[model samples]
Target: MTTDLVAAVDIGGTKVAGALVDGTGDLLHRVQGPTRARESAENVLRAVTDVVTQLTEHELWHRVVAVGIGSAGPVDARNGTVSPVNIPAWREFPLVEGVRKTTGALPINLVGDGAAIAAGEHWTGAARGRSNALCMVVSTGVGGGLIVDGRLRPGPTGNAGHIGHISVDFNGDLCPCGGRGCVERIASGTNIARYALAAGWRPAEPDGDVTAAGVAAAAAAGDPIALAAYDRSARALAAGIAATATLVEIETVVVGGGVSQAGEVLFGPLRRALGEFATLPFVRNLEVAPAQLGTDAGLVGAAAACWSDPDTFLIRGEAGN
Candidate 1:
């Protein structure tokens, strides 16, 4: 009746979540702490270590086997480093070693936050049992992971799923990656609101509702300006999805993130546009659905990854210590 365990860590711009994950991918002994973005990279790593320490010290944590970490991009999971564009402290930070040190030489698995989301879906969520699918996030920013032939493609530096960075329009807006018109810049929540603001929408109330969610609500309520904003964003996203389908022939697209809260308002038109633009007939059925795991997807995916490699699982020493 003993249970299997794994320590899963999710690092984001605002917070770091760590928990003991069972073989079933459910979290146990979960805890949280601030990411302290302005702090030094060492301080952030130290915070991650503190959380892992708590998990390892817990009385019932013995069954935990290894550690799997998901962090903000652009992560170099292969080399165990992170270079998140938003968090300046993490440039070339050695996060893997930090985890390993905290776990007493436990094997630590790492991947980009987007890839972790994909792994979570593939393991037990919406993308389960699918041969080709994408786990995408359209939150403050847009990002995603690719699964090809039912396998996670951790390309080159384990950052292969920079789908958001791909150009949706060459003559479109400039991107943080020094590119022009990336799908993320146009479709992300940030961009959605930015476009809405430029379209001459002013809030009547003092607080002001100038976010993508509010815009989506307005669009649903028949606001022409808001609808136009959503329309523009949805079209760009649809094009990106179609382009992805053209290459991978994906069967489903699982989208999550803050902006995805718009649901049908965002997806309906996106589906229509994808249908019209997707050239390959095989990709016509690329079903778009909401992500099931929400923010916990990263932790769940980390635990799920444990099932993929048993050798490393056995080497993890934290569960024993």
Candidate 2:
């Protein structure tokens, strides 16, 4: 059987990862380079170029027909530009142009990282078989994507489901994004640890790191402050999830990322809080499931973007089937 392949690129603050992926979602060859996000824009672009260069040298490179990119957004998919927040060097960077220049005239598909997660989930992860769903990543930050009526809805700019910046607490703390009490302000791992610390929680041993994972450990050990922090974060997440569901009526919410590794520590409270906020009859049956794709969602989804079938076209911003 002849194998068709696509070049997949996942670009973020920390790294630019690339792969040659077959139609079945298998990564035939992979390469990566540090993003060096604070450096000059040219330096960061060089890193991405390095990853692509390596992929082009792979034995399977000749079989690749198209290219797909899942990037940390504020992406202008309509114009093939990007302005990722964490990567300060890039502002309206011609990412598609850069990739095209390096890899030739192959069709290039670009989408925000959150939308890629949604695409991956809808294709093969926890959101599989769901007609409508939300896929979220709650780690250093909270990012999300929407699946509406069995299709991914990446708005014109490719950032339709940016649930992180949505205000959940009007009178609460100001977020770095200049929003008041955004969901990311409370539910992100950074804030989870910050909340615990502000509430007088401290590591038992000297010189111990203070992090959300540490807080989860303390919460598991019955620390009141730590448990309270998780509860607060969960409540904020529930509010955001409920709001999204009420607006679009998603059937399930698939969550991934580092903070979600807390397992029941986060989900137990999140489930309880969701029950309180998602009170509408239509959203009462929303299911919250752990994502199964782990760290590979971006890569798999990038490859998935190359296909223009009726189901996948939704993610590529074509009219729904």
For lDDT, the strongest prediction is 2
Q: List runs of model 1 lying over 4 Å from the truth.
A: 310-321
Among all windows of 10 consecutive residues in model 1, the one with the lowest summed lDDT is: 310-319
Q: Which pairs in model 2 have colliding backbones?
A: 131-150
Question: lDDT tens string, model 1, 109-148?
Answer: 8888888888888887889888898888888777788888
User: Can you give the lDDT of residue 103 in candidate 1?
Assistant: 84
lDDT by residue for model 2 (55-144), tens: 989888887777888898788988889988778778899988988889986778888888888888887889889999999988877888
Provide the lDDT at 59 for model 2: 85
How many residue pairs collide in each prediction?
A: 1, 1
